[model samples]
Target chain A: MGGSEHDDGRNGKTPSAVVGDVDDFWAQALVDVPRETYVLRLYVVGNSPRSRGAIRNVRKLCDEHLAGRFDLEVHDLNQEPWLARDAQIVAAPTLVRERPLPVQRIIGSLSDIERVLVGLGVSPNPAVDP
Target chain B: MDTYESKTPVGETITKSTNVLQKVPTGIKGFDEITVGGLPRGRTTLVCGSAGAGKTLFALEFLVRGATEHGEPGVFIAFEETAVELTQSVASLGFDLDGLVASKKLAIDYVHVERSEILETGDYDLNGLFVRLEYAIASVGAKRVVIDSLETLFSALGNEGILRSEFRRLFRWLKDRGVTAIITGERGDGTLTRHGIEEYVSDCVILLEQRVHERFATRYLRVVKYRGTMHGTNEYPFLIHAGGISVVPVTSLGLTHIASDERMSTGVPRLDAMLGGKGIFRGSSVLISGTPGTGKSSLAAHAVQSACRRGERCLYFAFEESQGQFVRNMRSIGVDLKPWLDQGRLQFHASRPTLFGLEMHLANIHRLVEAFDPSVVVIDPVTNFEMVATNAEVRAMLMRLVDFLKSRGITAVFTSLTAGSGALEETDVGISSLMDTWLLVQFLEGSGERNRGLYVLKSRGMSHSNQVREFHLGSHGIDLLDVYVGPAGVLTGSARQTQEAKERADAIARQQEMDRKQRDLARKRAQIEAQILALRAEFEAEEQEVMAILEQDKRRELVLGRDREQMARLRQADPNKQQNGGGAG
Candidate 1:
């Protein structure tokens, strides 16, 4: 997560570090909280527009519905081809929900929030949406 | 050659013809001959065999031959053996792998596919192998490629679908690069290749079998399928030795060998008389079969003597006896082979047939015949070949050998030892059909004696005698005496002698009776003549006496007649008178 900064430039959906201590506190809070936490990984081909759009859409969906209860990781397929091979990644901009039991995958920019939420097993609350 | 050059279609037709799956010669001895050229070029050939069938060695030798002899570079992608181990294993075969590698004519890449090292997190293909193979090929500019065993790769990949698709891609890649590739595979149960690659590499599929028959192991190679080419269908025996692998094609030369019309003597004059008095035709194969101790070897020795006496080179392969022993034995029978052997006209090569594999024996024979260039080659008792090979195998070997010799105009004689006296119809090797002349010798046991009888069973293009002659292995040599024809049948040995004696005795009795009849006729004629003379004399004397008597008797008769008349008259008169007087008194 500390290496999440876009040092190689040309980054659109750059990850924002919001309080390292708070993330640690959330990390501890994850054990105490009775809520289930989700682990997600997003694969992309560098910082392309489609990759950035997919990243933005996934992050917004997780923040709006499952904030502080989800862990996200991003991988540039070009930089880690072996990882892509290991995951059998045929297409880029793939979001794979790893944890919370039954794993799932969603391809393309992840624009449809409801479909992305359904694919990731995240039930959106109307109150949280408001 | 001129016709082929003139009949050539120009341009696009040439392209079309070349595109018709040209064969790439594998350069292995007898292999190219079997395939007529070799496997389909620019295509994959699957070589499947069980363990110890020399599958890896075959693939390696293909690459090696291609690299060294054909001037075509090769790359060997070994899946089971490392490059060093492979090199070491083939060192004894006189292949300098390191030197080939150094000169860039051959490249060996060991693709170590360990199942333990592979973790299938997801579905994967063997792209790593492809990259390595491609690199190896490019490194050597190889036109020939070998993948020694795809089974290990399959085990490592552990996905049949992915492996199959990857194999298809790999084969296509090899073809796209125009490489004649050999893919070695472990034999599956009832399948050509363990990975079932035969379906993919259907262009050519070769199957190798290592069979242990009668405690002797022999390796045989067969082309299961060859597309767009005519290949020998019979299984051919192959040998792996210090000179590398040699595939002995069943009859590689075929019937194309030109036959000679020349003739040579069989040494035994009477035996020669049996074979149309000219022995067998030069370059023709002759088979001699008989029971043990029936002078088959002696006949062969006689043939050797005849061949050598003609100042022609002779090769005598004696399986049962050593050269020294054979020479000594033949000398005792008046076949002094020692002089010919010393003069270099006769070469005696003696060895036990069990000393090596059947193919190796054939190879040795081929090598020796080529080196010696013998005009006559005599194999004493082809039955010895039966000890190492099957009947079919021996026949095949002899067929090839006969073809080779006949092509070179070499007279070949084979003596076979039958199990007993009964198998006159076929030799133990069952190669009677290959012989141009077949001489059957057997024991003619009669009158409590065993005599050797020789007869010509068949003579393919000659008028040979069919009579069974008495084959005598005397102190002077083989003597074929005329068999005795009598009431019982054709008699030989003492029976023949007895029959002859009886015939002579009957002829002498007939001559004496003829002489006695002539003497009796002479004596009877004399006696008849004397009796006739006496009769005549008696007639003459009687006549004389009659004449005399006639003269005298005529006189007397006349006198008597006269007397009679007188007497009669007197008596008649006197008596009458007396009677009358007495009557009156």
Candidate 2:
């Protein structure tokens, strides 16, 4: 609940803005919107293994650390390369944490779970790890 | 991609792989002439300069000129200035950027890069900039590109490795795409570009310098390197004005200008006579070096007036006097320059030598000469440039001016004021050799009077007089009086008058003495004739008396011989015959 996106019908409300208010049941899987949810964007280059691996690793790390309290949107830079200019994105498989103020970005396969969690300001779930 | 024509040789592909790099004319005034043709085509040229050295303006003018004149579309990638600021900055130069943009001939892309907004991820390759550039170029079909001040990129990116690789990539991309590019850079410490961009761009490098001396600001340009073409190596002065940046090249090609056989008057009849009755050559350069108040400016003014009278345009560059003061001063010397000015046949450009550097002044003269298309150009008192430039620099600038004017078949006259009394054989700055004709005006002081003396130092390819003529500024105009070379060597003013009067009196006294001697000889001849006549009359009277006395004696002897005559009559007849025969024998 950092800064809400204002849509004047030019573009539909982004998926991150649909926190727990949608007719789709999957959108309601998180029954209640967390007071502070993580907003993450994963930049990839189509269906390559490296992109799939980065996406899987980042999603696995996010689910274990902050399940039902995170919003993730993956973008294929090959299709939406113009979006890179906003963050001066240069490499593929870049993960950008856009919301919750003071955006942060990292470029890798996101294979190191602990580093990714630390970079995204998230802590692992102690009960799930035990 | 085919920026160059197919005529390029096969062996030249090493420089540019896709297209043969040709020269692209910048269309900047006096710039193309110096570069012999233009900048390297389809290649990035690095222009590095200090602050306020006209790097931005140079890049902007390159784009504008390409878009407007060469009919080539251009893209301006301004890193520091926005499109609105760029538009407003060049508005005074009469470049309608908005109109060009509306016509789709020019595209201005302002790339705002802030350190806070840009987050660096690993392995960045500036692909974002490339995409934007490609889009902009493809949108306008631009053939020319300008990335003004590439140093901003290094500062913004804050990574040398990325910047270097990106610079190389950008240059190669432009070359591959066959778009001529100009990349501006800030001057570095001990390097051509601030961030060492020179190491990346290898085709051409231009360096600009701005210096302040004696409270005068001057801008100079030099080509540090041009890979395939010959360029001027001297530091040339440039000017930034309403049009654009203009560099004045201080040298030209070999001596290939056609020497005209035509002649032009020096505006003074006697002066023309001294120049073998042909005055100066039509396209020759003349130098008039003299002391102050020696009619140097007047001589130049006369030449300009005569040229204007012939209906040929004339441009006068006055370094010491303003245009109004020059016109008024010429009027006082009986030279009516206002008429020619009003008629548009003559132009006067006056500025202090301290206003700019020597080369800048030369460039200004070159600009005016080219614009006015004048047949004759006069620079009054060229020595004033000594205040702004060294003697060597002045000479170099003058040599360029002379060569340029000579190539165009334009007559040039320069006046140099030699100070002090020791201006014997010194042409200030030793530029006398460049002049096709030199007139040395000097001061002749004698009999408590100062007069102007003019003599032809040299007139190449023509027979000029060796006599020194006295320069006279009269109410009717300039008149040169023949100098009197007497026992005093050369005399002028009252000394010449006194010497001439003495000579005339000596000639008249000589004639009177000869007339007196001839009259005395005639009197002596008449007296001798009277004496001879008297002697002849006296001798005649004496002879008559002697004859009468002899006759009386003969009658007395006859009476005495009468008694014996009867006896001697018979013998007398025979004796008389014998005596007559003896007397005849």
Residue range B380-445, candidate 1, lDDT tens digits: 877788898888778888888888888888999999888773556744436888888888888888
Which window of ten consecutive residues has the lowest lDDT sum in model 2 chain B?
B1-10
iRMSD, model 1, in Å = 15.2
Clashing pairs for predicted structure model 1, backbone only: B381-B415, B549-B553, B550-B554, B552-B556, B553-B557, B556-B560, B557-B561, B559-B563, B560-B564, B563-B567
Using TM-score, give the best candidate's number: 2
Instruction: Tell me the tens digit of each residue's lDDT in model 1 across A6-98.
Output: 232221332344676777666665553335567677777656566677778777887888776677888866556456545534334666666
Which residue ranges in model 2 land beyond 4 Å of their true spot? A1-130, B1-21, B427-429, B526-585
Candidate 2's residue-wise lDDT over B471-531, tens digit each? 8898778999987997668999878888889888998999899998998899889888888
Cα displacement (angstroms), candidate 2, residue B518, comes to 2.6
lDDT of 1 at B68: 91
What TM-score does structure 2 among the candidates reach? Answer: 0.80
List DockQ, one per candidate, in order. Answer: 0.02, 0.14
lDDT of 2 at A43: 75
- Mind giving the per-residue lDDT tens digits that candidate 2 earns over A1-130? 1122342212222345454656665454444323357777777655666677778877777777877666777776555655654544544466787765567766557777777776776766786661
